[model samples]
Target: MAKELQKLFEDLKREMKQEFRELKESFERELRKDVRDIKASMSFINQCYEEMKASVKKVEAENEALKESISTLKEEREALYAQVKEQESRLMQNEQHSRCLNVEIKGVPR
Candidate 1:
């Protein structure tokens, strides 16, 4: 009976060791999968960052171009204003000369 009990205990110990090994292997596999997922996530985040950086650079360039265009338009507007003033002065002089030429004598009957 003692021999039988010793054999049963040995069998139980072997089964327990096998179960522990399986559990350890499963844990390691899950850990490796988690690491791979993390790496993939990090790579995606880096790609997004690069795209955003490029977009920012493009917008900055466009902003500078717009500023230059605005400056050119401002200069043109100033020039047009000067032209309008010169034309107005010429028209006033012509009107004054015409008025002087058409003066009437007060005693003349129509």
Candidate 2:
């Protein structure tokens, strides 16, 4: 009876060890899967960051181009204003000359 009890205890111990090993293997598999998921998420985040950086650079370049265009337009506007002033001065001079050349012949006709 003592021998039988010893055999039964040995069998129980072996079964427990097997169960523990299986549980540990399952836990390790789950941990590895979670780590892989986290890695994939990090990779996706990095990609998004890179894309955003590129987009920002593109926008900055476009902004610089727009600034240059605005500067050119301002210069053209100043030049056009100068031309308008010159034309106005010429028109005033012509009007003064015409007024000086006018004649009053009122006594000879009536």
Q: Which candidate comes out best when scored by lDDT?
A: 2
For each candidate in turn, give its C-alpha RMSD to the true structure in angstroms.
2.7, 2.7
- In Å, residue 50's CA in model 1 sits off its true spot by 1.6
TM-score of each: 0.73, 0.81
lDDT of each: 0.97, 0.98
lDDT string for model 2 (1-110, tens) is 99999999999999999999999999999999999999999999999999999999999999999999999999999999999999999999999989997986777864
User: Which portions of model 2 miss their true places by more than 4 Å?
Assistant: 104-110
lDDT of 2 at 21: 100
Candidate 1 Cα errors over 4 Å, as ranges: 1-17, 105-110
> Considering summed lDDT, which 10 consecutive residues are worst modelled in model 2?
101-110
Error of 2 at 52 (Å): 1.3
Q: Report how far residue 71 has shifted in candidate 1, in Å.
A: 1.5
